[model samples]
Target: MTHDAHSALLHAALDAAERGWHVFPLRPGTKRPALHGEQRCPGTGPCASGHRKWEQRATTDPDRIRATWARAPFNVGIATGPSGLLVVDLDVPKDHSSSDTPDGATTFAALCERAGHAVPATYRTRTASGGEHLYFTAPPGVRLANTARTVAASVDTRAWGGYVVAAGSTTSTGPYEALCGPEAVAVPGWLLSILRPAPKVSEAPSVATMGQSRRYADVALAREAQTVAGAVHGGREAALFRAARALGRFVAWGDLSRHMVEQALQEAGEAAGLTVAECRSTLRSALNWSIAHNQRRRTA
Candidate 1:
C-alpha cells in the first residue's frame, strides 16, 4: 500500500511537470513545502553554492520528481511564478461553516458581474476545502506578485513568490482534483488591469505644504523615511518598525494618508536592503499595533 501511494504521488508530480508547471514536494497531507529551509540547510548538494529556496529549486525533471516522490508519499506543489501561471484562489470562509460570510467565488463572481464580464473559462481545480483555483496564463512581459484580500474578500492570487497545490494532491480534508479546462486560457485584460499596480507618483522629501499639523506630519514622514533608508542590514527591520510605529499615529489622527505613509516607508526599507516580505510584515504589524492602541486610548 505504501509503495502504491508513493507511485501515485510520483505520477502526480510528473503530471504537473508535463503541464510545464514547475513542481516541488509538499509535506504529506499538508500544504506546506517539504524542502529544507535556509537555517536548517547543511549547505550540501543543491545548497552547495547557496541556499536555493523551494521556488528556485522547483523542477520539471522526471528523474528528480521520481527520486523525490520515491522517498515518501509527498503532496505536490506547483510554483506558480516559474510555471508562468497566475492562479486565482477562491477560498471558503475561515470557519468552513460561516453562511454569513461570502466565499471567495461568490465575491469574485460579483466583481465580474459588476464589470459586465463572466468569469474567464480556464484550467480549474476544486480544493479540499470546497474552494476553487482558476488558472490563467500570464501575459508576456508582465510580472505579478502574490496578493491576499486585495481582489475581494476571500479572493487571493498567486503569481511570483507563490505556489499552488496540484490537482492530484490530497489533504486531510479531501483531495485536490482538477475540475475542467482543456488548457489554461490567457488572462483577460480587465483582470490584468486590476492586478497591475498603479504607477507611483514621485515622493520628494520636504515638499512645501500648508497647515501647521500637516507640515509636521510631512516633516516627520520624510525624517522617518531617511532614518529607515540609512539603516544597515542588521538594523533595517527594527528601524522600519520604529518608523512605521511613529508614523501610524499621524495616519490615525488623519494628518496623513495610510497609503502614502506605507509607500514611503516601504521604499526606504527596500533601499536599506530589506526584503519586500520583511518590510511588509514589519510595517503592517507596527502600524496595526500603533493604530489599535492609540484608538483604544483615545476612546477611553
Candidate 2:
C-alpha cells in the first residue's frame, strides 16, 4: 500500500475509534497472511518486528481495544476469538432497517453480556467513496459469518442508510465519512431490544461442596501437562505450557466451573495417556465421601 493510501486508512480507522468502534490496524509483517495474502493488525500506533502496538495497549488500557467488527464499501468483517469480537469491515446501503441490520452486532452483544460485558457500536471508514465503516460486537466462540447473518436477519438493509456488506471483501475509501462521535447514529434500542433476548442468571452452586470438584480438575490438568511434556520430545515443556495457558484462559473467562473443571482435567489426562477414568472415579468418590463426613461432623 502506498503511503497516501496507508495514511487514508489510518484516518478512517481513527474516526471509527472516536465513535466507539474498535479498529485493528493492518501493516506489513504484523500479522500472518490470510489465504489471499491480506493481513490484519491494530490501527493504532506503530508496527515493529511484527508486534502490534495495540496488543500491548490491550494489556493495559483494554477499553481502547477494538470491538470485533469491520466495515468497508463492499465488505463487512467480524471477529470470533476467545479474547473478544471485533468488526473488520463495513459497506452497505445507507437506508437500512431493523430487519436488515447486521447480525454480528446482536450476537456479539449477547456473548459479551453472557461473559459479563457489553458490546459497543463501532464504525470505520469505507474503502468505497464517501462511505463509513460500521460494525457491532460479535458473539464469543461463534464463526464470524454466523454472527453477520444474525445481524442481517433483523436489519432491513434498504430501510437504513446502509446495507450488509459481504465478508472477506475489500471496500473503497473515497465515499466514506471519517467522523464518528456521540452524535453518530447507533443501532436503535428498539431494534436491539427485539433482536437480543435477555440473558438468564442461574443460581450459584455451593462453593464448599465444589472445592473437591475444582481440585480434581486441577490435578487432571497437571497430569495432562506432564503427559504432553513427555510426548513432545524437544517441545514437551512448550506443549505443557500451551495446555496451561488454555486452562488459564478458560478459568479467566469463567467458562470452567467446578464440575467442568474436573472434566477438562480428565480430558487433558486422557490426552496424556494417564488413567483418566480411574482418576476421575477416585476423585468423585473422595469428594462424595468427604461431603458425607462433613455433614456427619456438623450434625454431631
Candidate 3:
C-alpha cells in the first residue's frame, strides 16, 4: 500500500469511529483479523476467553484506534452488530457463466420492488471488487442473522455477529470508497421481516415427536445449503470451510449423508458464483478437515 492509502485507512477508521461504528484492524491487503499467535484463534471453533476475539476487540474508542493504527496501516473493519448496523453486500463477477444470476444491486432492487419497499439511500460504499455495500440502522430488539443470497442469488447480508470492511480500507484491488456520507438510515420494516427466522410450528399432540424433529432438521439443512449458495464477499475458501463444517456436523450425527453434503456444496458454490475448480478443491479440503475434527471430538 502507498503512503496515501495508509493515511486514507487511518482517516477512514477515525471517521467510522465518529459515526459510532466499532472498528477493528484487519491485516494490510487482506480481510483477516490482524491478531497474531496466542492472541488469535486459528480454527473453526470458538476462541478461548482471553484470546483476541475479533468482534470483542472491535471498538469505537478513539484512544484504542490511535494505539492500534500507530503500529501499522491496518485495514478498517466495522463490527455490524456492535454498531447497530446491517450491510447488504452486492457483487458482480468479472466473467459471466451460463448459470450466473443477476448482479447484486439489480437483485436487491428487484427484491425491494417485490416487497413494495424503497431501497434506503443511506451510507453506501463501493467495494474493492466492482461491488457495493449498502448500510442501514439495525432495528431495536431484533437480531438480524447474516445470510448469503437469501433475497437474490447475488445479494448477501452482514447483520448481527458479522463485520464488514469499512469505506477507505485498502484491498488488493484498491481502497473501498464511500458513495455517500457516513450517515445510516433505519432498516426497512419489510427487510426486517424477511431477516427474521420463521418460528417452527408446534408438533400435533397426537403426532410422534421423533418424526417432527426429523422434519425440522431436514428443513434447517436445506436452509443452510441456501445460505452457502448466496454467500459472497467473505473469502471463498473460508466460506466453504464454514459451510462444510456445518454440514459435516449433521452427517456425523447421521441426520444427513456425506454424499448429500458434497452435492449440495457443488450446487451452492456454483450459485454463489465460485468457479468449479475452486469449489471442488475447497469442498475436498474442508470436508476432510471437518470429518477428522468430528472423529477426534467423538473419540475424546
State which candidate has the highest lDDT. 1
lDDT of each residue in 247-268, candidate 1, tens digit only: 8877886778999999999999
Report, for every candidate in turn, its global Cα lDDT versus the true structure: 0.82, 0.35, 0.73
lDDT of 1 at 250: 72
Candidate 3 wrongly placed segments (more than 4 Å): 1-3, 37-49, 97-100, 200-300
* Backbone clash numbers for all candidates listed: 0, 71, 0
Per lDDT, what order, best first?
1, 3, 2
Error of 1 at 207 (Å): 6.1
Least well predicted 10-residue stretch by lDDT in candidate 3: 199-208
The deviation in Å at residue 279 for candidate 1 is 30
User: TM per model?
Assistant: 0.68, 0.27, 0.64
Q: What is the full ranking by TM-score, best candidate first?
A: 1, 3, 2
Candidate 3 lDDT, tens digit per residue, 1-300?
577767878888899999999999999887888865453466433344455577777889888898888889999999998888989899885567744567888877865654455677888999988799999998788788787755446778998789999887877887688998458898776566446654323332334355654565477568767887776543343455567765665565565678888888888887887778767766775566556546521211
User: Candidate 2 residues 37-128, lDDT tens each?
Assistant: 11665433444345443322222112332232222211121122212333333334445565565443354344344323444444433334
Error of 3 at 152 (Å): 1.4
Tell me model 2's lDDT, rounded to 2 decimals. 0.35
Per-residue error at 265 for model 2, in Å? 45
